[model samples]
Target: MRVQDTLKARQASIRKVVETAFKKENPPEASEIISSPHLEPLQIRDYFAGKRWWDITFQGLFDDYIGDSSACLTFMAPAGVEYYLPAYLLMAVEHYYDGGIITEDLAYRLKRSIMREDLYRMSLYSVEKKKAIVEVLVFLLKEYGDEEALEAMRAVAMHWGSDYIKAGGQELG
Candidate 1:
């Protein structure tokens, strides 16, 4: 398939996961985050409050908080991470080239999250969510060849290989 078609399919897959796994989820409250004083959790909360994850367009995130979408991923509660991750993944997919450091930051953060075993914990992500994440990681690995994506997938294969395989992910080196 064409790249455009692939992107559209990935978008549709992500949307389906968002709809199924994250339906009716609320954004993180200021108190739920552990941001530095400068980052200001309240501002982050205010930006996301009253909005579903799907409602948050990538272009409109964190204009005041350092102009980086990755900041939103940092210090977020697991629930908040669950809510906001799809937007990040979508941004990484759609804006991979023009997005500058944002895409790399997304990959790095995701790598860190997976390395910490936070994202792969069964308590945090359901099987369906894990499957969706694997698909996204596969796309990042195959399409972008991002080092962080490779590291993240390696972590998954090392620690959560069973789950990864069950999620329909191929083995990684």
Candidate 2:
């Protein structure tokens, strides 16, 4: 199937899955939403398909509910929804370095996000999150990063790497 057609189908599936998960009458657990059988297949498909596909899937997560809750979005990590969302976004950024497409808006958002102190601090707390942030920043450096973004990402990599190493984390190499 054409890439656009496949992406559209995945977008629809993501919307349905997220809506069901957030049902007011009986909301599913965060873990349930993250690991849903229905959603996982689509996530895996998007990750493997290409960055453009994955971006569309990621975009579906930002419905009215999420948009209104943007201020609390980062704090929602403990609830699992925020925690798992970045993994897909990071995969999209990583795939961009592998000849995948990243839309200009997505790239711009990433450029701005990487500069936020909260995001940088969040990465310091989890090895997975730190690694994913580093990978995306590295990819962005080669693709969309300007001098300032490159500098910021480099500082982040150095600080996060040192902290992770001190915590006995293995090198990403």
lDDT, candidate 1, at 23: 59
| lDDT (tens digit, per residue) of candidate 2 on 25-101 | 33224443333345443343233232222233334444422332222223232333333445344434433333233
Error of 2 at 119 (Å): 8.8
By lDDT, the best candidate is: 1
Clashes of each: 0, 0
The lDDT per prediction is: 0.65, 0.39
lDDT of 1 by residue, 1-173 (tens): 69779778876776676567555566666555434455455566667666667766556663444434557666566666777777777677766776666665677777677676554233357766666667777777777787677676666666566567446555655
Query: Candidate 2: which stretches are off by over 4 Å?
Result: 1-56, 62-82, 85-88, 91-124, 146-151, 155-158, 161-173
Displacement of the residue 54 alpha carbon in candidate 1, Å: 0.7
